[model samples]
Target: MLSLIYARSLDYCIGKAGQVPWHLPDEFAHFKRTTRHHVVIMGRRTYEDHDTLLPDRVNIVVTTALAYRAAEGVLLAHSFEEALALARGADREIFVVGGVRLFERSFPLAQRVYETVVHTTVPDGDTFVPRFDFSGFRQEILERHPTDSRHAFSFEVSSYERVE
Candidate 1:
């Protein structure tokens, strides 16, 4: 299965100054649990921002530069199609965990999307998650967590499957 896992704000902002502006450990944990042991494809920036190989999962970094070499256990792909091809061989859930470009490119091809809709917005971000119409997706609310001292914003983890 091809899945896109991400967290975005009310206005679809996903990043601020090349990074996620919020620090919600629960949401991060949810991300890890969802994509664990899967093939994760991400843009070079997102991979770099992560600063390490995601454990227990195949990390595929998409970059245009021919000289780009990732760390050990990381695969390099020049295009989104190439990444998907590599991921298909894994025979596991393929998760697109990205910067803006990768998410935009893979949205159409994804069979499922696990998204955390943060109940706030960051107007300064240059990276935004593309708006997806839920009409074509069967939406299910997996869980909703209220904000606390650790979590600054209230959010819900929603599962969306393509209605085919």
Candidate 2:
């Protein structure tokens, strides 16, 4: 199955200065747990922004840079189609991890989406997730996490499955 995962604010803000704007450990944990052992496809910028390649998963970084070099064990694709092809070869669930362009390209082909809605906004955010057509999917709220000492924001994790 092809799935997209992301946590965005009320205004669809996902990042600021190439990093997630808020620190919500629970949300991060949820993301880690869900995408672990799967094939994750992300754009070059998102791949670079992350401190290290996501562990225990097949990481495919989509980029147009022909000379771009990545760490060992990381796969590089020149386009979203190429990334999807590589992920499909792994025979595991495919998850589009981030960077707006990749999401925009993969959204229509995704069978499911795991979205965490953070109850706040980031006016200064420079990166945002693609706005999807939610009406075509059946929504289900999987978890609702509240603000705690370790988490600064309250968010709800929801699953969306394509109706057809």
Superposition TM-score, candidate 1 onto the true structure? 0.96
Residue 138 error, candidate 2, Å: 0.8
List model 1 lDDT by residue over 22-42, tens digit each. 999999999999888889999
Error of 2 at 146 (Å): 0.6
After TM-score superposition, the amount by which residue 88's alpha carbon in candidate 2 deviates from its true location, in angstroms, is 1.0
lDDT of each: 0.89, 0.92
In angstroms, how far off is 135's CA in candidate 1?
Answer: 1.4
Q: Write the per-residue lDDT of candidate 2 for residues 15-36, one digit (tens) a residue.
A: 9998889999889999999999
